[model samples]
Target: MTARAFPCALGAVLLTLALAGPGRAQTAGPSPTPDHMPKPGMSAPEMADRAAGRFPQPVRVGDLPGRFLLQPEESQPVLGRVTGLVRRDDGGADAIVRLDGVLGLTRLGLQPLAWSGVGARLVAVPVEAVALLGEYVALMGMTPERLRALPTFAPGSATAIPPGETLRIGIVRPFH
Candidate 1:
């Protein structure tokens, strides 16, 4: 496929995966090997926490950019791409996500038709609400409509988080 078509194809595949539902079998091949198991010293609860992306770890602010923002749910899932980070006066961080319409089609380089009355907007999502699940950042209990309704993020008015700062973030380890 051409470079332009690749993004559309990828979006379609992701939409398909989202529609497949979490209960559906993701792979037809045999189960993964034991190499995907948790760490040797990790307790059962720790392993469970890691699987849920609740195990917090100190991570640099610079590493957060470019991660895809995902709302993982059984229903329609919302997707966005992180553009930057904002530092709040409370010493917390927020992720700037580019959301277009309900599904964030703008992130795929497609604009919603004028008749649809949808447009792209940047929203600041509290880092506390984020879960680092593998390479994707998961936001639980969020919907596209709710995300779209959030106040738009203004970089000029917000304090930007420096790349060197460290923040404690929850991470999901597929293989710990």
Candidate 2:
């Protein structure tokens, strides 16, 4: 088409689209379903929740028989600080923890796992664990504040804990 005609044609198309408005321009299409997609009514979040809850009973970290803790050369001892601890009615406690530094690991080690971060998690610990927080709380070389200074009942606003980072007790059973 001629240059003059081309401009006119483009203008007409733009005008048509503008007049059509967003609603009439395009109708919502059915979401694409992947071959390995979860079953209907079972969303990804729900599936994850179900998988996490599969292991109801909590196991001790030291009880795991095997060489699982075998350190790959890349793995560094990440420091974990206990920011808050709340005692549960069932004798277990909810702990708000903050992980320090990024510890690089192989794909088989830390891939698809968000373990290193500020997280508020439920843990299986005795009520007395609060009193002995210092022994349980380990932060490498840095000297943490007094045990009483840390929030022991609920997460304080100053902590600014992240959401969806709650690690279940069954997975990496809490220490203390």
Q: What is the lDDT of residue 59 in candidate 1?
A: 81
By TM-score, how accurate is candidate 1? 0.58
Number of the predicted model whose lDDT against the real structure is largest = 1
Q: Candidate 2 — which pairs collide?
A: none
lDDT of 1 by residue, 48-79 (tens): 35544566788888888888776554342546
Number of clashing pairs, model 1? Answer: 0
Over all chains combined, what TM-score does candidate 2 have? 0.21
For candidate 1, the per-residue lDDT at 49 reads: 51
Checking candidate 1 for backbone clashes, the offending pairs are: none
CA shift of 155, model 1, Å: 1.7
